[model samples]
Target: MNLLIQLTDLSIKTKQLELLQPLSFKLYQDKPVTILGQTGSGKSLLAQAIVGLLPSELSQQGQVEVFGQTHDRKSLISLWGREVIMLPQEPWRALDPLMPAYQQVSEVYQCLHDLDEESAFYRALKDLERVGLKSSALKRPGQLSGGMAQRLAVTSATAGGAKLVLADEPTKGLDVSRRDDIIQVLMNSAQGGGLLTITHDIEVARQIGGDIIVMKEGVVVEQGSAQQILNHPQHAYTQLLIAADPRHWKARDYPMIEKKPVLEAKRLAIGRNGLALSNGINFTIHSGEVVGVVGDSGCGKSTLGDTLLGLLKPIEGSVKRLSEEAKPYQWLKLFQDPPAALTCSVTLGVLLEDLVKLHQIERQRVAILMSKLNLAPELLERRSTEVSGGELQRFAILRAMLLEPVFLFADEPTSRLDPIIAKEVIELLVDLAKEQGCALLFVSHDPYLIEKRCDTVLRL
Candidate 1:
């Protein structure tokens, strides 16, 4: 088999902190490989290392070669889009927020060949439709559901001709139907090159249909066909991973928790440019009540959020915040990718301090919040890009809590997280909201979350 990528004694470290141990693997131009690991096992770090996108603070000791060319951070510029493509764990990070999804995806072709706007957009539309995001072409990254945003990123990464594709959790945040289509797209794209997918989703790993590498603590414990590794995993960690899917977990009903209405939307119509995506929507969120808004992609779930947060105007309806003295972040909204809601250029420290400055938050209180959210104090020093999604989500929650909002609008808050971390974050949100009597407007495609966590659900 012709080699597309090779790693020789490759390892990753963050200032003496070993993120990945020395490991060797070979990827052929026509073969696809799945790397399975638990969260924090350095699966993502390994992908970054091979792609030459590791942060400057992190160091690597090893040789990485792509298509017979030795690669380092500087050397990658010569072969970026044409030879190597990386689909990040967080798709939002890979996309440009300032541009619409269509325009950003169109740039992929513009990079390789000079094309007119119409032709680039035509190609963008075709590819996006393949991933089920053609309808979201005009939407910005912020306007899409987590799953939609992920597909948009796929459209870009897979657009340019490349010899090898490295995807980290590409199927994350997607529903079962879309997940299958996306897997097929990535696999079809790999017909011309090597496809190495790093995912915690065992189902995703299985459906992609290829060799599997079981990783634990950055060590390759086992490598074999998907049938052997998934059905009969040799490694203990691999077995654990295979058993960790949340889809099989039975949903339990919970007693409803409801209180006085904190916010109410009457006859709401959500849309833009004199259009209504969904109309006649009426919902009321009571303080201490967890309300789930469930719908399919393009069902106006996020549009309702924008309308509620006053980010989008209601074509014909009214929204009332009963709480007096409305302040910033009071009706706080958390999207699947919270970092997009933050200022990418600023450090977490600067954002946190600015938010809590008026309240004169004490160090002790800050520590308490961080501890509750399971975040390290040092994370405050890093930018949004440096921290992982779960870490930044915790900080986003912390920032929202500092504002002491009467209500919180969470749109796909836990969709991007791992099964275990997702459970923890959702539980934490409920517990914290109950403690503060802050109403929750939860939107998710997972029906179980609505049944278990929310007191009542509003369907669109």
Candidate 2:
């Protein structure tokens, strides 16, 4: 088998800290590999180092070779499209929101080969069609589902003839079917170039059916066959990760309290710019209840959440915050995109301070809560741009949790987390919400999560 990518004594360090430590691996054309680790374990960082996509502030040492050839930065400038393609963890950022999906893919084909616009367009369409996105060629990024976007990214990799496919948590937030589709696509594409996927999902690693590389705290701790890693783990962290999935986890029964309505909407219509996306909605959310709003993409789940948060107006109906308190209580939202919601103008310290002041909470109490979430107080000094997506998402959830809102609107709160960590976070949220008697309305696309955690599900 021909080697596709080679890393020897590779380590990456940002200005403040080391991200990856002396990691070495070789990918061959016939055998795929899966790298497993929790959030901030440097899985994504390793991929970035391999592809020369790491930020300028971060520095690396050691050798990265493609097809046994080591190319310097100046010479490696032209190596990306032809030799490597990465399906980013945040697929939303990998694409052009302004361009249609098919067009963006066509541009990839056009850039790498001598194809006319007409030919490229048809080729791109065929590529996407092969990944089961024939109907999505006309849709923009915002219009496509998370799964569809990932498939399109895969199509671009295949079209570009990349020798080594790199995927970072490709199935993080997708549903069961979507995850299967992505894994199958990668497996099929690996018939030519080997695939290396970085993930936190043991299930994803198992399905990929490849050698497993287990990483922890910036170092590789174990490497073996995927099934061997799952069935007979060598490292303690590896055992913890495999054991933490909700499938194997046995959650303690949560307190389901019977209480009056904490939030209600009547004859509601939701949309922006006077265009209604969903209407005639009526629902009552009581304290200690998880009202899971499940739906397909762009079915007004987020619109309803925004309207409830008062960020957007309920076009035609009235929303009442029927809290048990005398003073008007606040409603907090766990946004789908925390980075976008958390402004970059100020440091996170300022944001946390502002939140503390607004809620009249002590600084120490906030610090304690941050500690419980494994979020450092030092993160307070960093901006959203510096935080990883999982970290940002957890920070967003922590901020909302500390506020103790009478009603909490969560938009895919666990989307960026792995199933194991996601399960822990969900349990914590449910327990805290139950303790506070807070009304929890979770807007999510994962039907499995909604079915398992939610007390009442409202499907659209």
Candidate 3:
């Protein structure tokens, strides 16, 4: 077996503190490796370090040998498309927003592979068709659903035929079927090479079975074959992480209570750019009710939420706000991408302060809410980009809850979080919404989560 990558006592750190502890591992040809851990556990940092893409403020130590040779950051740049490819955690952000999906992948072939335009076009189509994205080939990144964009990005990234592929949370927002499809695509793409995957999804690690490394707090607690580590995890943290999967979670109980309609949609038709994806929709969400929306990728789940929030116009019919006492500020949305919703110009603490001042919220209430959400006080001092996805997401929820929203559209709120954090976040959202009589429109790909937490399920 040939070694694809080897790290000897490699570690990552910032000016103030260390992020990933010193670690050594070997990734060989024909064997895929997965790093499993919760967000903020430095899983992403390790991948970034391997690819020499860590931020300027963060520094790395020790040796990195790739494809039988040790390389510095300068030399590593030469091997990007041909030798190493990294599929980012947020695939949408990595895509070309202005280019059609087909063109994006085709360009990679034309540039990196030195293929003619005509040849690249046909090859791109075949790749897209293989990944079930042929129909959406004409769509732009901004226009496609999260899952669709993820698939497109994968196609484009692997077009160069990079042997050693680094995929970070590649299945972040995909439905179960689509997630499986991506796993298959990645496995096929890395044939005869090495695959190093960083993911919080236990399913991803399980499906990409070979070697598994479980990390928490910048240290690896367990390492072995996927079968051994996943099934018989010896570490306490690893056991807890596995048990947090929604499939293993118990159903929650809800007591009967009086209900008041908070929002209603009648004869609704929803879509983007004058196209209707779903029509003749009618649903009423009562105050304190948790409504779950489930469907395949690109089936207009997000469009429906936008229409209800008045962010997008409905082609026909109307959405009625039955809560007469609710103010405009009381209606909010928790975005799928936390960084997209937050501003990078200011620290998270500043954003919170601004919101508190604007809404006249009490300091005590803010402190209590942070505690309930398990958000560290130190997180607020950094910008949104500085915190982990799960932490930033919790902060987003904190901001939304601070408004005491009467209606909240939480779009895949827990998708980026690990199972343990995801479970906690979902439970917190449900409990808080119910306690404050806030209606929640929760969108998720996990049916188990929907079945357990939601009072009503809306199929798109």
Candidate 4:
């Protein structure tokens, strides 16, 4: 096999700390290398280091050679799009919110491949068609679902026909069917090129079926072939990671079923921008019950939640607030992407302090909730952008739970988390909602997770 990238004792460091331990590996043509680890484990930093996109505040040690030649940060810039492409962790963030889906892909062709506008458009259209996105050619990123956005991001990133593709959590929030479709796209794109993937999803690593590197807190815990590592993992952490998959979770038994109706939707028809996606939906959510909403991407799962929360108007029917005692502040939502929900302008501590003061919430309750959410005290010192996704998500939960919400809409809250942490967060949400007699409307793409945790499943 022809070698693509060779890392010799590659490590990342901040001024005061080492983020990634000295690691060595070789990526070859046609073979994908997947790094499996939890959030804050330096998996993303490693990808950044390879692509010469590490933050200026951080420094690196050791050597990195791509395509048999060593290149520094400056030299590597010349290779971007033409020879190297890095698909970011958040597909929505990577895509231009205002640009049409086909235009985004066509732009890559026009700029990197030196094609005329007409030719680029034609090629981009064909590419989208191949990925099952031809029907969404005119739609913008905001209009598409999570899975469609992911596919578009990949198609646009690879349109330049780069030889080395580094994808960071490409399948983070997608359903099983869409996830497999993306995997197939990546595999096809890497037919003769090199693909390096960074993911927390063990199934992604297993499906890629190549070399697997497991990292924890910047340290490489284990590395081997996918079959050997996944099926016969020798490291304790690896075993723990494999065992954390929701498919292996024991079925939970929820006993307390309160009769108090918190929210009821009758003949609800939900949609966005005057477009109806689902109609005649009827359900009554009782206090302390976990109701899961499951459907394929773009089937109106999130729209349903927003309509019930009164964030969006229902096209038809009505959502009744059965609990007259509950205040507007008692209704809340936990977003799928924590960064979007939080502001980067303020430190987490400041946000928490403001919330406490505005609500006159007791200091003891804040401390207790923080402890229960497993949020570190120092995390409060940093801005939302300064923390990892998992930590930031816990902070979101801590903020919401502090309000003592009577009704909570959790929209795929743990979709980006590692299985181990995802399970913990799910349990915490379930237990806390039960304790407070709160009603939960949870949306998830993972059928296994919904099956094990939810009391009732709402198929859209």
Q: Which tens-of-lDDT digit does each residue in 1-460 have in candidate 4?
A: 9999999999998889989999999999988999998888999999998989999999999999999999899988988988999999988878999999999999998998889999999999999998778988999998898888999999999888889999999998888877888888888888899999999888899999989999999999999999999999999999899888888789977666655998999999999989898999999999998999988777899899899889999999999999998879989999998988999999999999999999999999988998998888999999998997778888998999889888999999999888888888898889888888889999998888889998899999
Model 4 TM: 0.93
Best by TM-score: 4
Candidates in order: C-alpha RMSD to true structure: 4.5, 3.7, 2.4, 2.2
Stretches of candidate 2 off by over 4 Å are 13-18, 54-61, 129-136, 142-151, 264-283, 307-329, 356-395, 418-421, 445-448
Ranking by TM-score: 4, 3, 2, 1
Clashing pairs in 2: 349-380
| Model 4: residue 4 alpha-carbon error in angstroms | 1.6
What C-alpha lDDT do the candidate models reach, one value each?
0.81, 0.80, 0.91, 0.91
In model 4, what lDDT does residue 185 have?
84
Pairwise TM-score winner, candidates 1 and 2? 2
Query: What lDDT would candidate 3 get against the real structure?
Result: 0.91
| Window of ten residues with lowest summed lDDT in model 1 | 247-256
Q: Which 10 consecutive positions of candidate 3 have the poorest summed lDDT? A: 250-259
Per-residue error at 176 for model 3, in Å? 1.5
- Is candidate 2 or 4 superior in TM-score? 4
Q: Which residue pairs collide in model 1, if any? A: none
